[model samples]
Target chain A: MRDSLVAAAFELFLERGYEQTTVDDIVRTAGVGRRSFFRYFPSKEDVVFPDHEQSLADMTEFLAASADSDDPLVRVCEATRLVMRMYAANPTFSVQRYRLTREVTGLRTYELSVVWRYEKTLGDYLRTRYADRRDGTLRANVVAAAVVAAHNHTLRHWLRSGGEGDPLAEVDRALGFVRETLSPDAVPAGGGTAGEQEAEDVVVVITKRSTPMWRVVREVEASLGED
Target chain B: MRDSLVAAAFELFLERGYEQTTVDDIVRTAGVGRRSFFRYFPSKEDVVFPDHEQSLADMTEFLAASADSDDPLVRVCEATRLVMRMYAANPTFSVQRYRLTREVTGLRTYELSVVWRYEKTLGDYLRTRYADRRDGTLRANVVAAAVVAAHNHTLRHWLRSGGEGDPLAEVDRALGFVRETLSPDAVPAGGGTAGEQEAEDVVVVITKRSTPMWRVVREVEASLGED
Candidate 1:
């Protein structure tokens, strides 16, 4: 019944336009009573983001279950994948909703609120994991935002491509860039035990801007072998 | 006149609560006509975020003026500082709004929408700068989101402290971390000319996870001296 209502509402929205289409019109088109429509969705905006609440819950649960991981960032990335998959599960519905939301200012604002919730959830999970670290709260918020941004970047690309490509692969690649960039070891601070050791042996050799690559490589190899 | 209306609105909102406070009550409190109130603010919610629109405009102008810089990210960070200064300029008012928004879900959502516009502005600037680069769009979006997240993290910390202390310093530090972490050099891709030279000359040394840092450092010095 809920699916039928969503389908009917989408048809009405596309045909009659979002602002012009009323709940009465949607209920009439869906062949469902007003009470059923009210039970399923709170308002017209709610219908446009039908699966967001459920997806958010699933993401929270997924993160909660991975509380023991060594790297919370990895878990956050995985949780984001769950969201991507939810959209991928029904590309047609997702694409239609995306177009409608893009065209409506209110719906776009609503979508931002939904996206904020996801970022907040991811940040909350990371906060717990990095509670003892300095600037943990800030780190959690920044990393969560980066993950969401990367996911959205890939998701939008797929949507613009009519949802035909492998969005999961694109998202994974984007997430990989984020992880490599913002991971604890990548940024400067108290280099962990391993990081400190790596830092000690790694001689950061800076060459002239116009230095040739072959000479630099040969110089590095010779330096390493000299010991 | 606008400031007086905002002050009146805030007073009425505190007394009657956000949801219960009507536009009529605000006009009455300000001793202003309904037309004047409407001219200043479109809705009750707009009063809570009076400076955001102007702040966003300033940021856009700042970025637009720096379109030809070698590193657009530097300009983006500077633009964000303008927003920080705006809030810092009126600490008491900012703190009060922060508290009220925290207590009201609708205002909080509205605030998120405002923040999204800032992020979008930064992303739009970055997208143009990185247009010809690989994964440029994705990189632009992720970096912009990271910047906004970092700024918000610091801003919230200051607000939670009742708008006391040095928020600009804290924000600069946070932005510095982001600039270092997500900067073009931090992420992987085609190494620029100088980067390629540095990359070639830099022979990464990996000591065992448990290796003592002093020993690793001594070995590195010895190797360099041997050459």
Candidate 2:
């Protein structure tokens, strides 16, 4: 029934325009009463984004189920992938909604609010995970914003191409950046620069003068990771 | 005259609530004709955020003046500070607008669009600066969002505190994370762990046994820069 209403809403919205198409028109086309429409959707704007609430709920549940051992950065990347899947699940509807959203000022603002909710959810999960660090809250918020920005950049790229190609691959490449750059666990490979820290790293590899560079390189890595 | 229209609109919005107040009410309250009201602001929502247009223009101009020597990350932080200063310039008005925006969903969404413009401005600047990099667009968007998130987080903190405290200090503290973590020029100080690098940094010092440790450290630093 919800799907039917959404289909009807989009049909009327595309044909008669979003502002001109009333809830009454939607209910009439869907062959349902006003009560059914209200039961399913809170408002007209809600109909345009029928899947987000479920996707958001799924995201919250997914984040909530995260294990203590999980890397928060990787977990965030995984969580955002769920949103991409939701959009990918129904390309026709997703493309339609995206096009509709761009054309309407009110819907554009409404979409922003929805996007804000996703960022908040991501931020909340990360804040808890990073609670122990000195800049935990700030890092959580910045990383969350970064993840969203990366995801949206990729998603919009896909959408602009009319939802063609592998969005998952595109998004992964984008989120991979957040994990690589901002993840503390990923930092030691290069040191990790955000600002000032323990000064420049100084490693003294005391391999034999005849030792090959590769073996000396391996020894240096093993020693650095020990710290 | 423009200020008076905004002042009158806000006063009317506060007294009678945002939705109930009409443009006529604003014009009547300000003792200005309806034509004058339209000349200053296109709609009721515009009155709530009168300074953003000029501020945005200033921000764009500020960002456009970026030189090749400038660090894009730091430039973004400085650009966002302009917004912080604008809000700080008018405490009473800022507080009132913040409160009003919180109470009205419409205003909140409207504010989001204004924020989107700012983020876009920052992103466009960063994208151009990072155009030479592989993930230039992705990093630009991520850093842009991070800057705005940091700025908004600090601004809201100030607003929630009844607009007290040094907003500049709070924003700098927030944006400090972006500069520390995302800046490429800032990356060398930490070795940078974003991902796998040149295996590991192995610095071999073949100094005499009597050489000072500080001298060895300086030699290692000089060699590392050569890479």
After superposing candidate 1 on the true structure, give the runs of residues whose Cα lies further than 4 Å from its correct spot. Answer: A190-227, B190-227
* Backbone collisions counted per model: 0, 7
Native contacts recovered, each model: 0.46, 0.44
The TM-score values for the models, in the order shown, are 0.84, 0.84
The per-candidate TM-score of the B chain, in the order shown, comes to 0.83, 0.83
DockQ result, candidate 1: 0.34
Instruction: Give each prediction's root-mean-square deviation over alpha carbons.
Output: 6.4, 7.1
Report the poorest 10 consecutive residues by lDDT, candidate 1 chain B.
Answer: B191-200
DockQ for each numbered candidate: 0.34, 0.31
Q: Write the per-residue lDDT of candidate 2 for residues A112-217, one digit (tens) a residue.
A: 9989999999999999998998678877888899999999999998888998999999899888776555645222223332111222343333323334445544
How well does candidate 1 score on lDDT at residue B54? 97
Q: Per-residue alpha-carbon lDDT of model 2 for B181-227, expressed as tens digits?
A: 56443232224322111223333333332334455444434444546
DockQ of 2: 0.31
The all-Cα superposition gives candidate 2 an RMSD in Å to the true structure of 7.1
